[model samples]
Target: MTQTKRRWRVSPATIAPVLIISWAVTSAIATGFNFRPLVLLELQTQALFFRLRGEVAPPPELVILAIDDDSLTRGRDAKELKELASIRSWPWRRTAYAEAIDKIMAAGARSVAVDVLWDLPSERPADDQRLQQTLKRYAGRVTLAAIHATSESIGGGLDQLVYPDPMFQVDPKAIGLINYSPEPDGQLRRFASVYLNQIDADLRQSKSDLLSFDEASLQTSKLPFNAPKGDYIFFYGGSNTFAIVPFWTVLYPQNWERLKQEQIFKDKIVLIGPTAAFLQDIHPTPFGDLSGIEVHANAIATLLEDRAIAEVMPDPAWRGFYLFLALAGIGLAIGQVSKRTTPRFVLAIVIAGGWWLVGYASFVYGGLILPVAAPFLAISLSGLFYLSTGAANDQLEKLRLRRTLERYVAKPIVKEILSQPEDFQALLQGRKLNAAVLFCDIRGFTTLSYKLPPETLVSLLNTYLNAMVEAVAAASGTIDKFIGDAVMAEFGSPVSYGEETDAMNAIRAALGMRQALAALRSQWQQEGKTLLYHGIGISYGEVIAGNIGSLRRLEYTVIGDTVNVASRVEGLTKSFWTDILITDALYQRVQEHVEVVFVGEHLLRGREDSPSRLYSLIGLKGEAPTLYHQVHEELRRYLGYIEATES
Candidate 1:
């Protein structure tokens, strides 16, 4: 027997490590290299967390004094409201803001942060002095907005710091930078308490470290605020989450009684900034676009409520910890499970959903933000890897089975069995089918074995069996088994073309074996080796065909009177001096396609009363005349022996 070639197999032990390593490398690229797309994806997933959480109530202590279109346009045409009419257009007179501050302070507000920048003094000196005096009155309780301009030089460092006019800077702690730093994707999610700059003293003296407007307001309000140096702002909701009062409402005399009655600003931190569309103060947020004033309000509220979301550390060790958790999750999901695609896929989906739930719960209940995108991707990629490899493995397994089956069965039969596995499996369990069984054995094998050495005998037997197997295989017959020098084959088993086709193929295979034996005889005469001859007997009937034997060793073969009768018929070939014989059942099916002579009914060895009718197979009906003549002459040489046996 030829050795089968070794094939490469993908085992779980190999697949598991490869999956883990692939995940690790991908995570490293996402974290260590700061893969921009993945980072953006992570941001989007975090936004989903916010949506899942829905709207939350903001702190009542935070208020947004919006300088809206109503505040800017309502009093424009009101002739009785002369002060408001005079300040309808932007760059309103400083006295208008001064009056609003006095009213809010009198209303018992804790602190006020103005988000409007005041880098240059107004054209009217009296108006500037009026606002300056009001700011000095509540210096420690008020905060003014400033801005940092990036230099046009290389690296885009902070070039200059623009503060409120000198007259309006009543207290050093009153000035704070109102710069909003949005993420690369243009969403403002984080807040910085202080912004440090490197610049000369001449441009701005002793002001290298600037506080954010929200932080400055907290300090001025005397609130005990301690937070991370830099962190994410857990937004309460979208626009208008904080209570908003139009800027003009606080300054309008007609609303004064209502404001004082409502006490809307009582001990509250008020952020005053432009909120009108033309003001260009709209900024993107997790929930949606929010006015700058509302953004600051949310920031201050986050600090007051200690609702800052802390991110998992980004160090290698911390990232590895997260990766480990992801691998562990995937392993638990699919490890040691069946190699079925559906089950593995379902488990993977469950694992991903569970991880998302964990992340959302962490954010909602613990004020922590876990990495969602990278780990989720890891699970998905691993699932796809396993599914793809699993499919490949299935194909490989089928190939292995086909190769093994081909060793004993014909290639065509093996292919048919594999192609329709369900039907073949049913056949293996057992089935009754009309089929043709062929049994062929060497004539006088015992005498031949005695005359030759063991090696020569074995070689000659192998050559003869090889020729017999090829003939059967050519006729689409499965080589059932080989008993030493004999070959057993079956047609129309496991699969069938038709009854007539199977009978014709069996007769064709027997004739082919005779021709093969004649060629071997010529070859042996030239090689000075012993000649060999084979006798074939074919029977057609309903037989139980199936894989029969112990669990460890099973054989696909037929077991019935048909098989036994076929063997007994082959034993009579030598007695009758014939090469091929067939029972009447098979001859009736193939009689139109073959030429045969009826060999009168005779009781087989086991059947004492009932005898089987048989025929001597000569040649096919459509063969050349010369071929038929040659076969006729061959049978004529045995005529005398057959007549003498009858006598």
Candidate 2:
């Protein structure tokens, strides 16, 4: 039993599409993992977008009364304040905050939310009583911090609130929880309106009606905030985005009248909190570190204005759109390879850049955050995949075309064409090129074939054709075709090496064929086989050369008067009784490099008025005639001569 061989076919153009599809599938799967690399990249893009846009305007009604370094130092140096000042230390006397609250309320502040905690009783009973009196006097207008369980633990348990202070228990409605939950990366991107169960219990236990201070401010303003599931991704500006005034400036007697004149606290939600560096109330935001007080102001402003940051829809359909974009980019690049390749690459880059810009613009102008990294990575990888594989395909095509051409033309000519594909394409477009045509035919082949068996005659013919074909190839000549017992070839075409070189190559090929045939005849005679002879003709002139035929079947060849004349000249070689002959055109072109004797100007069958001058080729200018030429000259007068003549 015999097994049949199977052939596998591969197309060079198929590689680009395969790579594109693979990249799209792989990237889509990676994106589904919420891949950590793209997540980090998204964070960077978010930060950069905020930094480039700088600060956005905050709500005008929101202001922070900062308990800053000046308020803590009271215009004294750290050493002096520590050693000499009675009320200059941090966590200043509760009476000081009570006086500050009294001043802000008198100045017509809409609401006062103290970021400071009042979860513990003061060491001075008089100070606690004084702060409690102010809280009771403006119970509904003021709000104080209600420390939650977690925040209480963070503050060293000094202000941990099992309940509100006993002094303000009469006016517990003035308290709200001051707890913030930052993101996992320690950047504050959003805020919560209400606390969890633990803080909710603390609020109820302290008897505070508001969930948080920001919620209290929102409730007091009677503005509606439509957040999704009670969660808000609020817009953030840089540090100190809100109008902040030092706490001491409002509390000092001389500055109290100045604040009233400036209307700084009039109808504004004044949030009083520590802004000093030593207080460590700063939290990292996308723009920079911001004080917890300003974060609250931002939260209140977001609630009052109802401007929350929207997110890109996290749906499979949305993710698939980005994957489709990557596939489209690769398809576009591959499609353009047959035409304008440079514009294709430029457009790929522009599309990738535009994709990122769209994400950033959505965040900046539309208050929405769109997914950026996964899509960008997919597009970039697709582009690289197409470009790299596309290059490999081009190289494979060059190699394939070269192999096919080597069968019709010489190896050297194919190499030259492969090196410059552009020039080869131009030549195939049908152009007039200077070339030399040579025609060789076996002598008396019709009668000789009848004397031998069909198989023997065919084998002899194939041997002769092989010898002639090799001779043409060795001389850098293109084998145009084989007609019966004849061979037609061309030199200096598809590519030109000038008329002079073409003439020399054709002449050299004819001489080589003469020697090769002589060797074949000797071998055949030694083997007791009938010997064969052939005649050659060469002509040099302009010819129309290119791929000519119907679109479905084309052939690269030449057709002109020069081709006809070369065939007619080969007939004359038999008439002159010589193995080699050349027209006057080819002879004159190569006269400087080759030695030839004039055969005569003869009027052959077709045209009598136009007669062609022909010559017989000898050896090169400096070569000696060997046994073949010597025997040929003696055997026939057309073979060799010492001098050249004009007919």
The prediction achieving the highest TM-score against the true structure is: 2
Overall lDDT per candidate, in order of appearance: 0.78, 0.73
- Model 2 is weakest, by summed lDDT over 10 consecutive residues, at 638-647
True lDDT of residue 580, candidate 1: 85
**Candidate 1 C-alpha lDDT tens digits along 255-299:** 877988999989988888889987898999999998888888888
Q: Tens-digit lDDT track for model 2 on 302-343?
A: 777776666666664557556656555655554565433334
How does each model score on TM-score?
0.67, 0.69
Say what the RMSD of model 1 is: 8.6
| Clashes found in each candidate (C-alpha, N, C closer than 3 A) | 0, 0
Worst 10 residues of 1 by lDDT: 192-201
Which sections of candidate 1 miss by over 4 Å?
Answer: 1-20, 151-158, 194-205, 320-325, 328-336, 407-647
